[model samples]
Target: MPLMRIQLDSDRQTARRVVELHRTGKVHRESRDAARAEVWRRGRTPAGETVFVGTTNGEPVRLIYDVEVYRDVTA
Candidate 1:
């Protein structure tokens, strides 16, 4: 599966938010790691952006830095 590039803001708060979302089960470690690894592999870009690469069932998805967990209102 081709990895999807997920970029987050280069700030401490964004990093902390990712961890928080992970703890709440909103985000998976695999997804996070995949993203992190890709970033490390390519090194920092000229834009100085922090990116995370993830793939799910061969589909590409973009994860925002300031992600908020929202429960299903109608279920």
Candidate 2:
């Protein structure tokens, strides 16, 4: 299925931890996808969203992406 990024949260350390887990094979949850060695530590809300907690500046404060997700496509 086609997926889209709807939300990102950089307000908590849990967010960073989730992102690290997404890119690397370190930590994970049973509800998470396990098809690959490393998993994308992201999840969809009951409202139907794809959230991500990614970092850019290599710092906790630098990682901030509290947003939302959806199945909408852009042109």
TM-score of each: 0.29, 0.28
RMSD of each: 15.2, 9.5
Give the count of colliding residue pairs in each prediction.
Answer: 2, 12
Best by lDDT: 1
lDDT of 1 at 71: 33
Span of ten consecutive residues with least summed lDDT in model 2? 30-39
Q: Which lDDT tens digits does candidate 2 get at residues 22-60? A: 688554352132211122345433233233445555433
For all candidates in order, the CA lDDT equals 0.43, 0.40
Model 1 ranges off by over 4 Å:
1-25, 45-75
Candidate 2 overall lDDT versus native: 0.40
Superposition error at 73 for model 1 (Å)? 46
lDDT value, candidate 1, whole model: 0.43
